[model samples]
Target: MTSAPPRVLTVAGSDSGGGAGIQADLKAMLANGVHGMSVLTAITAQNSLGVQGAWELPAEQVEAQFRSVVDDIGVDAVKTGMLASADMVRVVAALLRTLPPEVPVVVDPVAVSKHGDALLGAEAMEAVRSEVVPLATVLTPNLTELGPVAGVELRTVQDRELAAKILLDAGASWVLVKGGHDGGDTAVDVLHGPGTRQEFSAPRADNRHTHGTGCTLASTIASYLARGYDVPSAVGAAKQYISGAIANGFALGGGIGPVDHAWQFRGSGQ
Candidate 1:
């Protein structure tokens, strides 16, 4: 009998479009050679164009799913996304606090969708800053999310660095400030942790169908962490993976589509 691979669980919402949220996380984990599990927090009526509607699951239900996975399956690492309410965020954070210190948690502060649909509101964002950020081993926030989460406006690279530092001081062991929305010739992401700062740059892919980029990157990092990679190494590898995924993004609906989570498996005849 073969041994089971590393286990990575995602606590997030369901994207009916199968592009972002829990769908993307599971796909990225599988592509990265981990056993993927999920605890669905909400359900979104979403597509390439935008999110039509979203309904958060009850806190009790969310907690039940999480305990079901962790108490038995036992996650090696965890990734969180699209926590729709302050109550839900608190519930997830409380559950995370129960995990052993060695278990890495990747928190993706998902505030808005690719097409400008709000997934989390002001109260929920505040809860994430106070409750979720402190428990995260890695806090992954894109450019638009940085200013709000850190309570500052980001205008330059130094501002981004400052925002990352604010998040680090808030208690996340590492903060990955993604520059995908920065609209430059190159996509640069800054990873800042204690006594360490690294810049990862990739040529900006000219693909309009680049949805799910953030969730995929964070999930890939958690997957690598589950596989025993250090924080910097895992984030670096995830950056490479997401870059390829972005380059291979293909059109689906009228608006933006999704990154190719299985881009590595392309042409493999699987």
Candidate 2:
């Protein structure tokens, strides 16, 4: 028989909107050819418009869920997003530390949602920096997440590089500072790591249905990492995948829609 697909896990919140959070993560993982699993940290009553309500699971529940999956199934790679509280962050970080170092971890510091809802609390900021971020094999931070995460002002690409250094100092092996918020014809992201710095640029997709881009990108990277790609290679391929998803994003709710996770299969009419 053919080998089984790589197993990837996402430890994050649940998005009822089905656009971002755990929903988007699983979809992206499947699109990238990985077996996806999840451990929900919070539940959000959300839609394309905004997050109407949210409730975080207790630390004990979060810990239990993580142990259940990781102890039994075992994952090749993992991605984290939308940890609602400081306690949750601490628990997840502690568990990650115990995992085999070979398993790559992609941490998406999801502080805010696409509709401007606060997914992570202010109190959790320090936990993210001190607890969560340090365990990341690849840390993916968007423009909004960069300043708060690194505690520095970011404007130009140079500024992001500086902020990346701060995160690097915090112990993340690699950092990808996403520049999709910047004004330009092309979207640029800088990956900063040991002895090398690289930039990945793609044409900006002019679609409003680009919700969940960050989640999709991070999850896709984790999926690739599960399939045995190195940090740079995983990030590069994931960027290409998300670019297509963004370009193919179609309208759904009254506000922004979601990036099509199945964009790769759509053009062929499959």
Which candidate's TM-score is highest?
A: 1
Candidate 1 has an lDDT of: 0.93
lDDT of each: 0.93, 0.91
Backbone clash pairs in model 1 (N, Cα, C under 3 Å; residues 3+ apart or in different chains), count: 0
TM-scores for all candidates? Answer: 0.97, 0.97
Error of 1 at 173 (Å): 0.2
Task: Quote the RMSD, in angstroms, for model 2.
Answer: 1.5
Candidate 2 per-residue lDDT over residues 36-137, each given as its tens digit: 999999898988898999999988898899899999999999999988888888888898888999999999999988888788777797789989878999
What's each prediction's clash count?
0, 0
Q: Give the per-residue Cα lDDT of candidate 2 at 24.
A: 99
Off by over 4 Å in 1: 268-270
Model 2 TM-score is 0.97
Worst 10 residues of 2 by lDDT: 261-270
> How well does candidate 1 score on lDDT at residue 21?
93
